[model samples]
Target: MSPQTDDVALSTTAERKVVVQSAGAQPDKDWVIVTRGLKREYDMGGEIVRALQGVDLAIRKNEYVAIMGPSGSGKSTLMNLIGCLDTPNGGEYWLSGQLVSTMKDDELARVRNKEIGFVFQTFNLLPRATALHNVELPLVYAGVGSAERKERAMEALTKVQLGDRAMHRPNELSGGQRQRVAIARALVNRPAILLADEPTGNLDSTTSEEIMRVFETLANTGQTVIMVTHEPDIAAHARRVVVLRDGKIASDERNQKVTSSLGL
Candidate 1:
């Protein structure tokens, strides 16, 4: 992640974020994400279902936040919108100063490719590919030259302290290492934000903590991270936690636990 300009003040407190979101305007570039009255709906057998009634969120660069909710809380819908996988029906969503809600499919695809790096619960690595090769997948898709792709992939892997494991296959590496490889791949593009959906779901408790520590290191290095999960303990690993209920944010607060524990 690149260092953000000092010209913009940090929106650290929930009160500050409220001020930013309530402005109902596109935030400046320093604020990487802003939403006003974001909404999502579905029609099931002629019955209308409101997955998200109205969601207003503001996130600045280099913040590590977690979005957590129980089943039917619309957290997934919010994640999709933030990840650029889906658009809201009636709201404004601005990402890095662009109105994402109005972008067409092609534009959304490009934005997704350029701005967001995603980590799924499933590592999603090619079984036959080595860790280095797996980390090169995104660059390969972007048509990056082979030499540059390999170089960037190695740099990404080194960020997660996995450079030594680059040539190991997924089956040969432990679950934690494989997840680290996935995280490295996500970081290869130097996206503005890293969006992870239940990234530690498949790992054991110890391995999960290992992955969280990697995230902690990344956040310390100025990576903007947004994690969506149902587990409170996992959410506690983030510097800020936003809980959603009934399709709206129920609470947003700084996590003293993570802040003090991680020296952030």
Candidate 2:
């Protein structure tokens, strides 16, 4: 399908996903993902549907930010656009100082693989593969040697406290462990930014809290994290919150304590 068509599909899928995964809902100073007047429209049954009207956002590197809004609020559309999995119909997007808005689909994919680490709500782990294998997939795409890929994957798993589970398949691990594996996979590349769409959507409260702690640790270590969430409590864990309403930012504020405590 065409890039435009792909963007539309992602919007529709995102809108639907936003309904069930609603949960809690970023940073400033050194913005890593910036967007201005971003818009996305779809030709649905010959009618146009606007997913994002105009969204303006700025996320800083090493900052933990959450995107929150109600169903049909265009939060998911914003995630897709920011993740570089899809592009906007009209807007200016600068990711790590690069004009991603103008890149072709292939170029976007290459940049995404090189600069972004994505963690999905579903964990997105390969069902039959060992955690080590799944975590190494990105390196394989980047053409890293097998020996180096194994070393890097193991190092990532260790960072997430999952070194012992590396030989286990997704099905063999618990929900929290699986998510950690996914997180390890995302960090394996050490991308410019980590984009997580409902990263803890499927986990229980306790598990979710554990995941948030991991994110906190990541941000503390200077890893940029941008997550989309619907629950206010979950969003509270972030250093900054960007509230979206009908695709426009309604509020942007930092948790002074979290921000100051970490010096982020």
Candidate 3:
């Protein structure tokens, strides 16, 4: 099926409900991610902070989704949970058909390494490492051989149109180039979901659009992407937008205008 068809199929409220309901049964491969009644809370000096309250989110394979919210709206918390950086205090999280919310630290680490590719707002490339080396870091952690890692890293850099800059260090590149390297690093792992948190936050408007175009291409080519951002314009690039308020989902809608504008 075409990417456009997939986008429309997943946008319907009925389809979303089906995916969410399937989360409790045997996992469906079509649903790349599912969170059922997910909840998170924290205690600070005897005061409780509820970061997430029963958030039910289902993202299908090849979906391009943006999770948006204002400050203190729990978008960051939800991103953490989805990325396996943090586990929920209650409820379930299934990624690639595996229940991961209750996984141990080491198990979580393994799942994170295998299932999620994360791009951060700060462009978290190693300062001293070359772009190629930075992109190879995840493969190194996975115990891939040096030659294979190098090959895959080079391929990822080429995907981002940074093949010629493989030897360049982060400091040697412009902000846009650095973010491209970070994106290459994220994609090098061939993860199930590309989870980007404020990926273009540090860049100027022009650079942000450049990165969004890269994301758009990836999504069009059947990559599953979940982005967390507060900027409406940035979020608009996604095919679907889910807004959060007071630790709950306020609205979920298809961005038909943005979708058509991007030719997705």
Instruction: Provide the lDDT at 78 for model 1.
Output: 95
TM-score of each: 0.90, 0.86, 0.95
**What is the overall TM-score of model 2 with all chains considered together?**
0.86
Location of the lowest summed lDDT over 10 successive residues in candidate 1: 1-10
Query: What's the candidate order when arranged by decreasing TM-score?
Result: 3, 1, 2
Model 1 root mean square deviation, Cα atoms: 3.1
Sorted on lDDT, best first, the list reads 3, 1, 2
Candidate 2 lDDT over 140-244, as tens digits, reads: 998899999999999999999999988999999999999999999998998988889898899999999999999988876778888899988788877778888
**Backbone clashes counted, model 2:** 9
Tens-digit lDDT string for candidate 3 (1-264): 476656543657777787777546746788898899899998988999999999988888888999999999999999999999999999899999999998999998888878899999999999999999999999998999999999999999999999999999999999999999998998898999999999999999999999999998998788999999999999998889999999999999988777577563
Model 3 Cα shift for residue 167 (angstroms): 0.8
Off by over 4 Å in 3: 1-9, 262-264
Q: Could you tell which candidate, 1 or 3, scores higher by lDDT?
A: 3
Give model 3 RMSD, 1 decimal. 1.7
Evaluated against the true structure, the overall lDDT of model 1 is 0.87
The per-candidate count of clashes, in order, stands at 0, 9, 0
Superposed by TM-score, candidate 3 places the C-alpha of residue 165 at a distance from the truth, in angstroms, of 0.6
For each candidate, the alpha-carbon lDDT, in order, equals 0.87, 0.80, 0.91
Model 1 segments beyond 4 Å from truth?
A: 1-24, 262-264
For this target, which candidate reaches the highest TM-score against the unseen true structure? Answer: 3
